[model samples]
Target: MTDRTYIDIHVLHSVPPSNLNRDDAGSPKQAVYGGVRRARVSSQAWKRATRVAFTDELHLPAEQLGTRTKRISSLLARRIAARTGLDDVAAARLGTALLAQDLNIKAGKKETETAYLLFFGINQLDAIIDLIAERAEELAALADDALTKAVADLPVREQLTSGHPIDVALFGRMVADITSLNVDAATQVAHAISTHPVEIEFDYYTAVDDQKTAEEDAGAAMIGTVEFTSATLYRFATLGVHQLTANLGGDTNAALDATRAFLTAFVRSMPTGHQNTFAHRTLPSLVSFVVRDDQPVNLVSAFEKPVRSRNSGIAEESARRLAKELSRAASSWGVTPLAVASVYEPNSDQNTDTLAAFGVPHSLDEAIASVLQAVRGRLQEPA
Candidate 1:
């Protein structure tokens, strides 16, 4: 069997009355699992939230970042103008020419646009500008053939992978028309779901006009109902360490740093859906990490039957159920990870041993540090 490295993370977090993820109709997203409706948060929503955290919280450099947009021409145009001191129109023309040679753009369009949304790293953009700058004289000479030849020699893939953004490497990219530009996501995020059955709740609210007196305006100015739900959610994500390392061009140290930042951000980030209406910001009550050689395991099946909260809260009960399920699953599969670490709130009746039995228990900060050290040690060892 091929020995591949994988990192699995599981979290039990409780969100208060809020709509963390919503559908087109502005209702909380839901799915039927185990023959019952469960509150769900889409993978896309959580991934976007996590990516935002990488910038806002982790403070990663912009150079090691990717942008997702359909306005590729415009973005490149602005960058080219800034770098080359060219007029907007000239820069836009150059941008279109460069993108047309590399990307599979449409024909006869006044405004340059990709056929679909594109994810491009900052490094790639800079490389394109550098290539243009190297041939600035030729470009200014208005020699079409010379400019075409110069653009043709540009190495798109090399530039993209040289200083790849952690988010882009983890989440991946796809250029539909040009399959060569597609990148497979190194990380897989499962849709977060409640551990118990959930029913959508509605809040009817109204706003009164401040300018009009009660005598002038007897009725409310506007009124609406918002759909919401409260649940203790189970979130799971797995990262392919081997794939991540490869995506970063075999820089193991960068891989370890990226992994550490990802773990910290994932635990802290929260989706901001209707945040003004329902301010539901929370940290995971329990966080577990496992590094193993075997295939990644998701303990979500533990909640297939659903956990009912009795004396304790849903978060506590869900934690208990998850711990039990993980123990049984690991034993049955005859799987032992290279390292394991977990952080959990104290519970008198809960079986803390279920987790501590596998690996050391630690606080959130300690857990992150320990996991990173373990990963770094593993990478340091020779194959």
Candidate 2:
């Protein structure tokens, strides 16, 4: 068997004065790394952005992606009613009964809501709705307790177990009440942190009413202050090929496609927080893909001591540090990665020599293709 265990992606991207992610106080998030304050973008925010890119950039079908919401019961009830010729009221009652009895997922404070958000496949919902519709007449007439018990023995949970959505398989699902329904995530995304110390900056200004004259409105119609920061962030993510293939039901082709889509999402996606005001939609300057048989390695340690540049821009220096760190790590660990590919764009310009570890100059598309080629060769090798 091939010993490959993980595919790791490292990125160095720069964003202008923007709050790509914010805390409760409406200030940009910060993390003290290496004894210095660094601008931060939470992993959750980036993961959500990746999911959105699956639809917006890749245009994958609904069946390939899942929906996330707290009102899953209501959504399922509506679908069940539409497909089963049952009334909405009856569907609501029946939906809650079967879900509680068979799945053990109880309804929340709101009858049609769950205690937490559920991420599930679109096709999986249809399978469930159809399962309910199969015995709608009998199930609807039964008492709540009886309906719960009657459906408890059904194969409802199996529907959820099968046909895992790409996002669901990658990011995973947590069914608190029903542990059997949970899918282990195949990917790990690290929070993006600046490669240098950062200070939060504030933009304080006043807005004047356009229609009202200065004589009538005085100095201004409104006044406010906004917080933001700019930095070159070092981001990382790792994916387990084994876990992904298992989640995809041993379908290697599907796993490969998912891998490609994932690479695209992570490379291209951007968090949209305050995007309208700041428009902080910048691409990464350097991206490297590493496939390893050993454990995934993160290159964030390269920036443990913040990089400094004198008006030449920090991306080049940052890339130099990252490249050196990866080389040193591989040497120190005595574990060579199975394959590596990259596209470097220091100053938003692409090149091959920006990092010696990554050989040829490749566009983003070519880099993804390279990783996939390496993965397929390794996975398909004869044991």
Candidate 3:
């Protein structure tokens, strides 16, 4: 069966549907993009909030979530053992040991933990007891023969020395697998570049305006656009059905099941702004997965920034460059899905020319709504 699995995510500064020129806070009263100033936000603030949300939900590293072995194993073990006959001590021992062995902790001070884990994972004690009970009749028959002797032959660590390492790779341990990461990024990007954008009401002087006249008058009033930094990102990851199967103890079926489950859970749980986490508003419709890096594709990450130049539209051009790099990265990893990141500055010029000086070009104000749609269309088409 075809994997038919890929993700398309975008992040931006803010979104406002209409108007031109922002106030002192760097938000758009309105500006021009896609040949018109629809509304605007900044990319940096969106990414920051979204990143924080993800870290909190997954207990991920302060910087990145969804890729650490310890975090995944510990989380998975607890989930698997829940309401099962297993106790906490047994479960922890199983999880920690399995993770240690999977990471290839051969010999060291940590070997104690590793050995303990291996024993629990294989359930040696239970297996030995069961075997002894089942073979009682055979042993009783052999007792009449003086030449026969009984000896227990329990396997030591040497028994598996010649065999390949135990499989311990669990899925859903990275941002890629956490579908919300992509969804949130896409949602943030949409918010950054929308036609009518939402702004946070942090000013104490501002009163709630529910009246029709107040609403009408609010159009020209200055407001704060959500701010955040967005970088051109390029990401690649591979799911080695073969290596994965070996890692899961040669159970191809189990590997496939786990992969499917992980992918589904990740996508379903993706987080976004104040609302839903996995907002599909800016998500691309079609996705493509290549066997290697270098395929011609249009989606990328938001981490990498391009070299600056004197060009006026360098930000969008940088996005194009990032798309190209994304294609290359996917081609480099056999059967992996990779994304590219394009830097975007949603608001007007700021005190620091960080993004502008770095060479990321700005977009026409209306470009936000269409960017994800355009990228999705490109990926959905056949090669």
Top lDDT prediction, candidate number: 2
TM-score of each: 0.93, 0.94, 0.29
lDDT winner between 1 and 3, please give it. Answer: 1
RMSD of each: 2.4, 2.4, 16.3
For candidate 2, the clash count comes to 0
* Residue 297 error, candidate 3, Å: 12
Q: Which ten residues in a row have the lowest lDDT in candidate 3?
A: 179-188
**Deviating ranges (above 4 Å) for candidate 3:** 1-168, 171-235, 259-269, 276-281, 293-383
**lDDT ranking, high to low:** 2, 1, 3
lDDT of 1 by residue, 271-382 (tens): 9999998999988898999887788888899889887887787887787788777777677887767778898766766566755533656887898887777776556323
In terms of lDDT, model 1 sits at: 0.81
**Candidate 1 TM-score versus the reference:** 0.93
- lDDT over C-alpha atoms for residue 187 of model 2: 97
lDDT of 3: 0.32
Residue 136 shift from truth in candidate 1, angstroms: 1.7
